[model samples]
Target: MKVKAILIGAIGIILLFGILLTPKLKTVLKTTPSDEFIQLMYDGDVRELTQEQLKQYKDDINQELIKLKHRQSFEKIYLSLGKIASLEEGYEDSNNYLLNVISPGSHTNKMIDLKVYETLAVNYIAMGDIEKGYFYFNEANNVAYQLQDAELVASFYQLFSETLLNYTNHTNFPIYLLGEAVELTNDYYKKIQLRKQLASVYELNGFFDLALTEFIRALDMSVEKGYVDLEIKILGRLSLSYYSNQRYQDSIEVINRYFELSSDDPDLFYVSLWLHNHYYLYGYESVQEQLKSLEEATSNLSIEQKHQLSIFIDFNQVFFLHSDGQYEECERYIRKLEKLKTKTTISELTGLLIDKMKLDLDYDRGDQGIDYIKEYRKLLSDLQLTNDSVERKRLIIDNVLHHLLELGDYETVYQYTADLQKPVTQEITIINSIMNMIQNSSDSHYLAKNNITSMLLKLGSYVLSTLAGVGLTYGAYRYNSYFKMLKRKAKESTIFDPLTKTLTKEALYETLELEIELGQNELYYFLLIDVNDLSSYNESFGYLAGNKVLIEISNLLKIYFPNAYISRHYGQHFIVVIKKPNEEELLQLITSLINEISNNEKISAKRPITCCIGVSKGYLTNTLDIDEQIKLATKKLQISKQRGTGSCTL
Candidate 1:
């Protein structure tokens, strides 16, 4: 029996040694130098990969794929990096690979799903399949919502809106989508960004008044967030919007403010562009100084920044030079711009080509300008890009009209107006017909009376038949608007602590409940704060001063946890629930609150203030009532206060 037991023990030891050694042996044999793959990604040098290197990399990736244990997680990182590398490699099959990977049920990570969708949407957009692109963009947005990531949701919406703005069939979609984005995000910076995008969309749609409103909102939010860079950008956009709406004085004021804030930015290209455009509109001479400043600043920019800066500079310079009668210089700049055009993004290229066409027309180079216009049309057709090219088209038509008018070609001008797509020309025709009909009328009073009588007759019957319909329509519209307003108000209130215009106890409770429901699943302490000297302060300094101390404490809470929810439980007591507070953060917050209250000038004679905090940490069970838990914490707090003037008990 002893020999049999010895044999079993020896076999068990051998089996244990084999189990421990197997994985290490396999790892040593199979390991390859992943550094090259990692280096290519980190250095962004995939474009320089040799064909042999690419083949080796593909083979290695295939081998890695076979060996991957965590397929779902591994594929996410692989495909994301692969997509970037594929784009750099200029591979024709890259888009097909991306599309195949973005199929349903392929990715489980919400962030991965968002990236995949975005890649696919961009690819589709580049392919001129806007409808499919938008569908994928919307799918990505839904995933962002499911993930409950407000920042991601806002970003997707911005991209989706911009894409829609570039399409003629769905211009209005962007306006509404941006409005929704602004509503979803609570961060001041993101709100301003969405507002700016919305303002741009509104301006593109010819809703100047609405555009102004959104731009002003963006400016205010930028100021509130203390975002100096964004504030300057918004100011520039505001100035542009005002100029577009013909509010020249407002434009000047806004542009002057932009100059003030953006004086330090090395590349003031946008400012220079705005100045040149507005100068042409209002015939202002001050733009020369701005132009000089811009030229000085452009010397320090990096190549990429210079590339962007030069586009705007050239765009404005084309017209500025023409207006100054430097046609030769303008032609030189146009040629320089054409060389740089190939490196430009699609949007920049479109704007530049259109501007070139306009400059050619302005210089009486009509035949040459028509050639440029044909090129512009081909580019637009090829890219399927659309926007308010109405103004540019109108400028072209106006030049044609003026040229024909000067040559006594009235018949041709009339025919041209009939063929033009400009709303202004259509309005002019309508107004001329109305004027002619009035002039031909034999009795003006009789015509006026007939019009009034006819309008009244139609209005009476229309009102009688549609009064209920109008009321119902108005009721439905107001109801939806009101519902949205209430939802927004509720969200705003949730972030506010009602007692001191900070976070409230109810808000804290709701936040905790949400965290618990979301499976944070961690053990943390809840602190019950009781004001020990509040009664003394109330008696000596009056409740107003006492309230001031409370407000000071609340302000300190805000400083400690700008995103934390704080709540007042009673007249002199507050509560703070932290996920897990370290000794440093908790003690620092308490010390700051006490010091602020004790030293507050509004506290009358620098009244002494003190507080006690009780903390408890354990897995909270459903059996323990919240009020009972608070009472237990308060008892511990009272004991701490007895031990010292300002103390914490745990």
Candidate 2:
């Protein structure tokens, strides 16, 4: 699943870059629209709808525009219509409306016009008029460079590549373009797209090392952005990349981490994908046990979910039969696969899996499947080819399809640029709107005929009114933004320590209290962990180094006891509480953590940073206070510290 996610990212990068370089066919009305919002509309990020629903949506926009008294606002309505047309794949209508619209040529409009040119380029490329497409593409590129807009530049790199892939056999070219795009943008989401594309290109070309590098980069970005879905996808890809690179243990470890991250995944799709990856890594028997566990975990699924799970379960059964050398059973399961093929589009991943199953069947059949083996090997060779004509041709279409899929996934994450100004606010937006109107107006004679005093008076009043309106609007925006930030911070601070991100002491106690009240019949263990020589390390190597050690140790603890309640009180002191673990289990966990921490090469430390662990275990009840348990743990911690660094007392 993780591998698939990483590959998806790679494919996303390819698609984005493919269209970005394909042709700049997408044209929009010369109006104020953000690059992100423009991309969203172009990518059909708005909710998918039937033809009737789409017409109604367009009618709604038009009706809303009709109610507006301002003539200037009408241009915005046309732009909105153009965007909708684009979404509906009515490229000709979108182009005509965007190109024929009466628009102002102000700087803001120029930026929008750049997008229009790019849109037109894509439309043209899709229509098979590559010459016209490239012309518009160049025009858009020129405008983008002239404006010095990094975001637009980044977007172009992504979108142009996607467009190009539709019409040409450019398998590896999108990677370079996307890599440039990655360099141009600081936006986390954008970089994620670029890196994923580049990685996908590399992975498709059999450049596993390069693919892994980009996947890892994208994975880091996903983690930083707190995009759980993206993180899961990246991890799955990372694990698969590891597997492809022949790092089996690394692959297994990453798959385990995927499970840890998605323990409570609410989606059946996510669970099914994870299970698929698990089957590949752990084989049939282990996956059967996993499926049983999953069945229990997802027992309360909806009817729709049950249907999806059934499909996935059947798919897994095919693999299980094949792995078990039950050739007849596998042959029966092949019918299920054939039925599945009719239900969904045959994706590259699906094709690959099908081929593998066929190969397995052939291996079992000996000379009976010789021709099948030859054909299968040939197909695999084409897919893994570095330099082949068939591979090149396939990449052109594949890259574009991948880009479209990426856009859909991106919509799921970003939802059409939430930060874009509302249509109401955008219509009157700023001084630019007024300036564009004045500059483009045909009645310049009327303005010239007015007396200087009269014109000055009108201009002053208009400027003052616009400025006042802008100030109030900006003030409201800031206030709301700040309020949201405050709310987020307040919530975060209550549950987490500001620096370490571990649970706050209060939060830890609350968790313990809640668990105790649940009346569980089990022993709960509280452990106090103190970093040995951390202060000395801080003094010798700098505070940043000490913080690094703290963070690394905290992460290790989290990994070792993901379900446990953990907290940080003093700068380098941590409290950990877990339930009902045997002595051997506890020792192994601690020993593994200690070994990893001491040998940590990622941290730039001169010597090993060790820890003292003190533990206290007892039944949770009203008779025993949580604070008393901590005190006992702290006492044992003091003993461990006295004994030596890396010492533990229970």
Candidate 3:
């Protein structure tokens, strides 16, 4: 039913776009209602409802079909029934029936035929048959454009975009299709809607800064056109983008603007809850008053709206109570949230909150809290792949690590710390060092400050005496030091990049020269990786975050191909040369590395750090200059950027 709702929303826009391409359906040969009602089915014996209930539902649809007199009307009803059967009831055969009935040459409106083809594509994608799904999807798109109906084309593109984004493995194609939809529409609001939809897709892919830019563009249009509702929505999203990039002050300012614009709107309460959660630490009393006012204003909200608001409001209260050290009160609110878990999407957050509270309560009671530790560990294992590495998750995991240290559980602590360190920022190295220190200090007693000061003074005196003796012989050392300095500078100038520690361009060329002389027949593959949106990331999250990402990428490349010749070129691009015999193996390795870089959730917390890769393979020969190979790979990298931001061009 939600899928139906979404489909209606997307296609509903088609009519507004002025696409009147509805064709009539041909008459169905006399097939009585009792001949055969569509039997709904599911895979792996997973029935959504009992067989009897499904039969009755099909009977109702068939009865309605029987009442329709016109052939076109009957076909329309059949399409609706097919949609319900396939989407809501998991009827695979109903999809096939839909395709046959609304086949391209059939006597049906272009809109109905287009919908049927799109629906089939969506179903196939959902069922894990991407090749057939893409075939039908492309079929629907081609027909829409062929009809030369702007609205139909836009509609097909929009819904098809959603299907690909939500169900399939691909994202770039859908995003490109959405851009096409936006281009096809001249309507201001429709264009804005399409842009916002595109931004949501970007946001889901962890491209927050890109999403923010889109939101800002749409916000500008909303302001110019006096579209208050759309403006408020965009402001909300823009604020979240700011928050994710750690621009808290900007986030607060945007939230304040949103509050001013949406004071009397029905969505004000929900917006207030978002503000309360994010900005509560800034002004507890003010946020509390806002919550109270929103609660008193709840009578204006619908039942469903109230449920949604209550879930967040209560969750925020749990956070507030926990912050205030009201563990008992926090538990009460946590329990309240758990009860409403089935009614909300915040169930996972609630479970995390509960686990955190239990750990704190157990610690307060002076127990080891082993059960709480085990519970949190299990939850972390289950959620690690699915959840982003946000600050809250880090704090929770770090707190657990600190608890483990307190309990002298170094074995468990070591395992979690090691696992957490891989994707975390370089700052985690400090934590690792601290853990090592703690583990070493566990069997020792603390030295008194006075005793340590005395020992430090004795060691310092001895070091100073040795240094003074050495300083007496400085004349003899100066000439040798000057020669060493020259040698060090010469080596530094020739070999590694100062910033990234990879090979310099000159060094890479020199290596290429040597390889050509010795291994001319060897297959050398050149991989060029260009970080996408890195400049935007620097603008949004500061240059430090951008530098961290670059360093991380360089480190990852080193780890993956220790023997390869790697270089950090000017800007946010890295070049790696490897002598693998198989081109397919090289491409596969490059693809996996690109995916790893793109989906690194730790870096994604500040900004979605993504990169495009271009891989070119050839033999190391005297005639083929390294610069020419780099140029070829750079050309492919540029093409990859055009095709899609985070794609690979081979």
Q: Candidate 3 on 1-650: residue-level lDDT in tens?
A: 99999999988887755454443211344444322332221111213456676567567767867676666555555665666666563658768568667656568766666666777877887666766676677566545533556655666667667765555324434555576677777678878878887886666445677788888888899999999888888888777677756777777788889888887763544365465545544666666787788689776879888877777687677667666676787778777766654655654644666656656665655354256556556655644433332322544555655564444444565555344322222112322332333334433333122222223233434433432343222211112222334345447656877557788888888888987787667777888999888899999987767877887889889987888999988879899998864677767777778788877865676756788888777776774567777888998888898888778887
Taking every candidate in turn, the Cα RMSD to the unseen true structure, in Å, is 35.5, 25.8, 30.2
lDDT of 1 by residue, 211-318 (tens): 888889888878987999999888887876776566777777877888888777524545664675667665635665676686786698798887777777776777
RMSD (CA, Å), candidate 2 to true, equals 25.8
Q: List the residue pairs that clash in candidate 3.
A: 23-109, 23-110, 25-107
Full ranking by TM-score: 2, 3, 1
TM-score of model 2 vs. true structure: 0.44
Q: Tell me the whole-model lDDT of each prediction, alpha carbons only.
A: 0.59, 0.64, 0.64
- Report the lDDT of model 2 for residue 91: 84
Number of colliding residue pairs in model 2? 44
Q: How far in Å is the alpha carbon of 222 misplaced in model 3?
A: 2.3
Candidate 2, residues 430-470, lDDT tens digits: the string is: 22333443445465554454232233235645643543464
Candidate number of the best lDDT: 2
TM-score of every prediction relative to native: 0.43, 0.44, 0.44
